[model samples]
Target: MADKEATVYIIDLGHSMGEKHSGRKESNLDFSMRYVWDKISTTVAASRKTWTIGVIGLRTDETNNTLDENGLEGYENISVLQEIGPMSMSALRELRSEIKVSKTKQGDAISAIVLASSMIEDFTKKLKYNRKIILVTDGKGAMDADSLDEVTEKLNDVGIELIVIGVDFDDPDYGFKEEDKPKLKKKNEEILSRLVSQCKKGVYGTMAQAVEELSVPRIKPVRPFKSYDGPLTLGDPETYPNAMSIAVERYFKTKLAHPPSASTVVVNNAPSRSQVDDGDEAIEDNGNGLGAVRQVRAYKVNDPDAPGGKRDVDFDSLERGYEYGRTVVPISDMDESITNLQTKKSFTILGFIPFSSYEPHLSMGEAGVIVAQKFNEKAELALSSLVNALYELQSYAVARYVNKDNQKPFLHLLIPDPKLESEADCLFDVPLPFAEDIRSYQFPPLDKVVTVEGTVLRTHRLLPTPDLSKAMSDLVDAMDLSKFGKDDDGNPTEYAPIDETYNPTIHRINQAIRHRAVHPEEPLQPPAEILLRFSKPPDELVDQVKKQIDILIKKADVKKVPPKVKGKRKRETVKPISGLDVDALLGQAKRTKIDPENAIPEFKQTLGAATEVKAIEEATKQMGDIVCTLIRESFADINYDRAAAHLGVMREELIALEEPDLYNNFLRDLKKKIYQKELDGDRMDMWRGKIIAGGLGLITDQELEVSSITEAEAKKFEK
Candidate 1:
């Protein structure tokens, strides 16, 4: 079962909602709140008494003292109808009688959202629960997009999901006149869209969808603990009179929380079979004319890990016990059901396989392959943490069938596989799962899993694929060709470890061959089968990249040469003036004289002369380092705006140093590094924009290509 949940329903009660819509007898306000009540009741039932519901009214009647006694001014006509509480059948039944339509105009949607969020926050304070808000409106109220955006952010910050259900958006056959129907203005739609998008967990739909889906509980997939069921045989056919078969089930021993239970009551008036001891029994007289005695069922309570906690022992059945004179007691029906929550089992290992090898059998196909690969890249740190855990434990893994179906197996490493040396006439085999057999899988909880840092694993979403359409088309064509088959080099299509452990047969054959080398008297081993290896990238693609890199390098070399002076000017030297008498000259020299040229302040020296070549080089190197650091940091943080702004600033600073050519060279170099680093389309586009927006100083206005993938390069790949 899911954790406890809280949902706040913000219903619109404006004059418009009083009119009938979709030819329904109930007013729109009534219909929307009824739908909200249904959702609350359904969620509570589905969650097994774990959900709470709160109701708020938008554009509520200001004069109604029962609903708005506090009369919070500046709240924009929003009023609390029902405080948040656990939903019950009685509460849902009484919801319709409590809500009433208002004559006032619809309240500002943004204000209502803000007010409802505060109510949700106070209710969920110190409580561990999933928070949600359902906004029911006709999408008619005017709202500031910016305010709505802020509300969305705040809700997202507090981990609240906002679901907006717009009524009468598409329905035209309503009881209201055609002119009276809400048009769903573009501005309102846009504001709602932005709100939903920014909320992260937010959802938006029409009234029809809400009616159909709101009552249905959302079922999310959960990871299941797996155990294997197989037959174990013993005794050799020649030595033993008969072979015996034993059933073996393999699973991890897991501690699970006990489900909550309710009290059982027995009345003297009713016939009942009770297990309560006389000493343990407590009786109370009912306040009735008959004065009947009622007995409450007694239960044992203890900490989750306490050994004396309630055990599942059936009083109705018995079996043989380990002791000669003892009998095995059957667990009570109640205890049996609770005991089934926990599990324990055993397994025998076959061999080990890589995660890449295991991924294909997971049933996602081509798209899954790409997603898994991206996940491997994005979640590398988390995977490394898990790998480090194995190193700490000094553990090795082996493949084993995990469940009864036995169609798929996982890498079981924490627990070592049981040895089969004692058993005879036994066969061990691992069957790889076919694509159709692969079901969705979830990782075990962080506490149960062994990881170095206990870092939580994050599942990344599918990234934008701007060029996927073309790539997919090309893939379809390649697959259609009958001649496009296996590689001539006898390589595996997918990555696989080329080691002795990967193939037992190859290891045995090699061992035999080595033995024959030591003892020539023994028969020589047969030739070994060829091992599959990974094929190298096609020469066409490799050469294309190399050519592009070479072109870039040559271009950089050309830009490095300093421009020659057009014409050398002849230098003219002036002779010094004659000196005066020693005494007069000494007096004049002692006097403080400030020339106008000397009084004028001197700015920092610019990089111009050949003598300042070393200085220029140092300055350029420092500036390049700073720029590269900024660019790298911005790209790493995915701050494209910051990166663009920094790039523009660097351009102006570089131009000030009088090294425009050098700056241009740096741009080309940065572009090359970005290309080599494999920045995706979005990053590349931002970099390109930054270079262009910086104007003619930073980069040439000549429209130089920056992505490194020229038209020619793309065409070469097409071939």
Candidate 2:
């Protein structure tokens, strides 16, 4: 299991591959390609540079391999579809198109294997790479058995693994045996079996079995990387007399993994001439060219002397700068180096504190394990003593860690975890936040309200009452999940175990990608039940808390607010319970004017007294005249607010009466007269500040039903 791999697939592309085999609707070539596509797609999804792939088509119509091109014999009808290199989406497209049935079914599988071996060996001569050769065939074409021994020895010497897959081949173990198979096909299968058997590392199996196992999910093995490895020192070893050091190594205990991010692509309608364009004839056009889009950036600054009032600058001409208060301080590369804090690689302990004094919430980032040096008995004993002593005292150590020379220093907390019986004598370390990383935000007190006079009240509306508190506590108690589920023996246990709850975001994305790769045509299935197991509360738990929830809602006085109606507004006025005539009786002697001294109340009473649209219209005219007179006779800005308030009331009353045209027309005339200085010498302040700012300019169709006013016309009128 090496990190670097060089796997080449020798796919059979003979004429017979285009034909169907035993009860399968798809051709043999398409059926076998399911496995190849899945494997290659997985490698592409990983996006690793070390995982490379090569494809060699066997039993092709032409000869275009290294062996045949070099004038060597017995290597015809074989082509090198793709060179061994870093596999990407572009290379995958080329390999897929290169795999097609040939007109002539005359080629040797053994020769194709040799060709693949030479390509792999030439590319990875003495380097450390996991070399593998996979040959897929229906065994219908010829396979020379003369150089079997030599090829087997060469593969073993080169340390290459061989795998041969036969489509519709006999396999007693798989409960499949093709009846009445051709003589040549049987002989070729036997030859392939022997070739795999003689090799040191090989696997000979039927293609059906391999394709069936493609749906099973596999876990990728990761190589362990050390985050830090140095001495754990208490006090400066060179400065203190009681200083001590323990040789130790550190490895990740909880490493983070990220899901694959989606890339932006654009479908090109024509051939692209850009250098980074990915569309070519090798990829299927599907009636439209598809290419990955690339992002470009530019920098510009405003310049009065330049054309278009802007000047473009090259990115290389710019220097990095940081903000200092209200100004930016530019620092050159040389100046930055002088200001940077540099340190050497070391792990030194600062001091120890009681476990009670150290807060668990302060520890952040990935956790790691600090262990004694490997195969060093003295270091192991010394570290073990430290672990046990810290464990007994219930204390933790604070340490300063520098990963490498010139690297930034970080604070870490190391907690003792000693269980020698299970060989777990180690200290777990987690990164600690600096003072700059800690955030302190002040929030208002939840239990009491403080008045402006420094009086503290605990019985305010924001505070919960005794019955409300009790009801909440009862609801919380009923929703407890501990010991809620039954175990195998029918005993109560924890409802949701930590190990059984899978991360929905991580697993769901992976499942979708895998399904798409295997079944390109079928719709995606629902997420597995295990992934959604802990998404919601159990039915039994919800049923038991129904009554408690109702009690809590009643005690808290919880009520749902009515939804706000948008677009259209309707005014609802309730009719009197008893037959009465209040506004109608007052309107019998309709007051024709609004008093200037008490205009607001008198104007409101006039409108309230109106019983018909004609009376409402007449009242609006009187108020409008009074508002104009107030602005005309005001001493300065004294009556600006009063005029605005009167206009606001008129606007609301007319809108309620479904006669917005009256207010709109009056406002228009007032704006025109005030701007022209026809009312007095200058009244622009009242017109701009009151009419414009107070939103008393116009009434549109949105607020009134009968009157019509376009939004654009209203804006023009206000302006």
Candidate 3:
């Protein structure tokens, strides 16, 4: 790949080459010619074999003159300066100098590419690899859909990398005209994006600056054999050999070690042999640490014919002398009686009792005494029960279970002592010693009640205390009496006149009084002293003084005038001299002169010199005018529409190659005529009109015309 050769073909398709931009002597084509020439020359000089170069010009079909053998072709391919070797600077310069600025009729960019592809086809076929065709255009293509696709496919098949360098395609102000807008112009952006995607080496640029940016070389990473030992790693770990083995070895070799300890010992004691009985029962000591014990009790296994009658070794028989011990004691009658007593009645020896008449208590008298002795205690207990019941009621309300058919709030009454229960029963009306007083309470209606624990009668019997009349009367009396004051019509009036004593000062009062009073009829006046000090001068007095001065000046002028005199003499007329002819006098001088032949020659020479001098001066003056006109035109905003119309006229003049040399010379001469400073305004306009008409194929031998041309001529002019 590194040894392969790369060829880049650059084509310029800007409409400025069509001779219609900025009204300047140098068209965009001219600039492109110089620009690409320099670029190719430089690239060739730097790396000749590695790079190949090509160039093409693009314009609309209306202005281009060069054509293919097939008449009225849309595109023209200019010859490229081929094989510009690294050492051939002179050849490059020669090629650059040979570049001619010609107009193209078909500025459509598609035609430009087709022409460029045709021209570079030979060069592309010869190259084995890395072939590239870079288009440097102002984004104007006009080939038909079929031809465009064909040309594009051809370029792609040849493995030619197409790089488009779009230069100011959207800038109509630069060179492009509005009328030249392509039918497929809207797809230009999408086409450029697709081209870049397909070409792999293609790029779009809006300016020379963007072109420079695209030309910058990209930097590639250098693949290294070893990875760096740092916080950030960017190499593949798999490339390193025995990495896991090295890690395991490093781990085991660097670990610490320790030793083990000894075991513990325990002692056992047994009864002596002398303590065993003689014949009553033999004793034995087990070596496995069982103490010496007499076998006074022994049970035999089941034997069918054994002593006393087939004794079966029953598990029940093993307890003949030994009684089975129970961990828990059995209940005696007295204990059972006590348990029954404990179960039948609950003790109040230790439990919470409310100290309030409203809450559960020992007795009403006791509750009353507690409430009197400890008001906060009774109140706290009562409030806690009320709040707890209310909380439960709220829960029932939220659950929507209150006052439901089966769901009812229950009240539990506890009477640890019969005396307390009897007292509770006497206060209430239930059958139990302790009765629920809810019978007297009137509960809220079924729907309204969140939880009904008692009868509705209790709720009705309980009434809220009536408010104190004296307190209500005092509150009413405390309100301001002025707020209730009314007018005679019985309508309430505003509160008593806001204390005027605390109102504004006397100066404010005066201001208010003045604001209410009607405006005076007389004109407002400043103080008399102020008027005297600042009055304007009197107009009548000043006018009177000025009039008197005018009269005095008139009188002085009348006195200074002098009297005029009248008298004159008439002059006589002179007669004409017929003998003294102007030509004869000049000729006699010439005849009487010594050395007449030399004099004649000198006179003729002098006359010729004078005539030449006058002519030169006139020419210089005309050149100065041309220079000024050109300067003004260059700086002036170009009328692109007019210039484009004139370009159409220019395309008509250059028709066939019958006088190819003459046509070329005429074009060169036309360029010089338009560019020269000596051309007058009318003469320049005439020459410019001729050039435009010639280029547009609108000109004829009968004095170059500016009118429209036939379609055939227009098509020919387009090429």
Candidate 4:
């Protein structure tokens, strides 16, 4: 069922609105009217058949067009342009024609509020709709506080929300003189603030903030995650009894109330510097001639007159024991008992169907509408799982409430992303708005279904379902991963590449459904196949290269020689005793200790150096081979960032070994291999920049002088 709502726009047409407001292209009246129209349009589109919009101009020069609603008459400046009605293109066009700047005096703001509230109340009297009155005005109008209070009481009694968007002042961007702001009536300003506050159902802000807010669809608070344990059956129970006892979870289309916080504050703990003089009093001198002396109090524990004087005790005779002071009591104690709150209901998954088959049902009945996935994590997972599962079983559960008020049914799409199921306690999480809350969610009639190779399609809407299953299979098969990113503990970590735009599974099903509904007349076409193309490197790949180059340049900038290890010195020998005084020196012999620090082990430099050098060369050779393989594989499915990062580490190691020639040669060869691959001009430029940046230190005057040697000559005239 559609969410019913009524929004009545009360636009100010006072002569003051004709004045220019900063940051707006049109006059204040014109801008406010347009903003109101946009808000109405957005509300209508989002709410569909359930929303209605009305327009009421605050001040109108034409006395004949004045409104006489709710028994009040002679409101010469007020005009009822359009009454509340369902939104349509014609209605919006009519509203645009009616809104204009008033050439007469301003209308009574209190009267305008009373009239708008009455109109909204009348329109939403029979229907269960949310009543709202959006007032757009400048603060220079006149109103009595008593009248405002009366209207506020009426609006509150009718449960009508009043949102006041005042074009109170010129925007900072507009170069308006200080004198241009009109002197607003103090009583009118106070009344407007009081009216909005007393109602306690609306918000107040500038037109700019209000206009920005209307651009996006308003959403409710996030429903909590839920899970169920039961058997899920699919198809007709009498004919085909296909069922599974799978642990199921439901996710709602919702988002967190607040954004992930990245705000931080840094504290400066350095002591402040101040001048002090050697005296009992401190002298404070200003730039002026006069100086003031401030008395400084000092305390000495050793003085007998001091509050905490030194204690007298016999230290030698006292027993060694610790002193205990008074025990401190806490202000509050926490209840440590664990409370287990059951926030989910157990429901059986009744049936399952292919997402392609489910697409048409999303746009079919007036009673059932599409429910969009809220968070990106759930959306991305659902699309991926559905597309991939289409290759195998190609079915998702359709759940019904075991204990609910309405007991209505809705499609239950499963998003079996591995990250969601990594938790040990549960299979996955489900979100709320369960069967009790949902009403009239009916699937499309099965008899009218048309199947193209067993995949269901609605006969009324002739559309082709894309072969997502085939595409997903090919994508999985194309992955030839040599390695994955790992943490310091050597555990492989999840790597979500930045270039997710190319992935066909990102919100695939939902986007398709929305597109179909928006253009119901047009036949659905298959989405373009996501072929593994490598003509141009993705933006992320280029960014990765630049980041790697930056790191390498920084490393080369802070290059330092390894600290030298000093060998131990030779040990000195003890003088030999002339005579073996057997009995006398036997005890001294036992007490004598060896000088372990001075006893140095024999050092062999040449052999150790050769062995270390050989090991370095072998490791470098292996890494070089891996780098070359990855460079070639980059044309396929290999991650360019990982390859570049490995190459950067290899370059650093080679530089540490003082193998400048080898490092330069490796870069030159790597460049050739990259160029040989299917790289476009942009990719070629990125590679060139990376090479120049990373190999800046490795360049020598000799290499520069011999740079004239062409690639052909170097290969052909090899010695």
Number of the top lDDT candidate: 2
Task: Supply the global lDDT for candidate 4.
Answer: 0.52
**Tens-digit per-residue lDDT, 25-144, candidate 2:** 999999889778778878877778899999999999888898988898889999888889888655666676787888888999999999999999999999999999998899999888
RMSD of each predicted structure: 37.5, 10.7, 57.3, 36.4
Off by over 4 Å in 3: 6-10, 13-15, 18-27, 30-38, 59-87, 118-121, 124-127, 170-201, 211-719
Clashing pairs in 2: none
Candidate 4 lDDT over 1-719, as tens digits, reads 55677887888887878987576677888667546755665554443777888787887775423246345564657887787777754455566667777786657777777777877887788667888988888777766466666787898888888887777433344332234455564445556767888896966666776655443223332334432223233334446555333323333333323322322222222222233453776554432222345666553336576556764445443333333566543222122112223233334455456646644333222121111233445444443444346335745445544423334333344423333433211112133344455468677563456456767645433322233334434444434222233556987643333342233343233334434433446675455333223334445545545644444445335466765322211222233577555535666432122122221110111112223555545455555565555555555434455556656765554444445455567656666655675432224533544434444324343443323445454443221
Model 1 reaches what TM-score against the true structure?
Answer: 0.34
Pairs in clash, predicted candidate 4 = 226-430, 250-430, 250-431
lDDT of each: 0.51, 0.83, 0.38, 0.52
How many steric clashes between backbone atoms does each model show? Answer: 8, 0, 47, 3
**Every model's TM-score:** 0.34, 0.59, 0.25, 0.37
Q: Give the TM-score of candidate 4.
A: 0.37
Q: Model 1, residue 708: displacement in angstroms?
A: 88
Better of 1 and 3 by TM-score: 1
lDDT of 3 by residue, 1-719 (tens): 33344444445533444454435466555544433544454454344464555444344222332345446555444334343223243344455444444445345555555555555565455766566566665445443444545665777776666766554455343444334455555456456646556553455544444433322221222232211111111122357553211010000111121111222211224353234444545455433233344545445665768886556464554432323484445555555556542211111111122423233332232110001112345433442343344333432101101112223322222222212433211111101123653445666452232336744342322322122333334344443345444676988654344431221233233322222221224343222232232144335434545644444455334355553211110122232466455545567432222132233233222222322334323322333233334333542324323433333322221221111222333334444655674433234443344335444333334322222334565345434
- Looking at candidate 2, the ten consecutive residues that score lowest on lDDT are 279-288
Candidate 1 least-lDDT 10 residues? 364-373
**What is the Cα-based lDDT of residue 255 in candidate 3?**
16
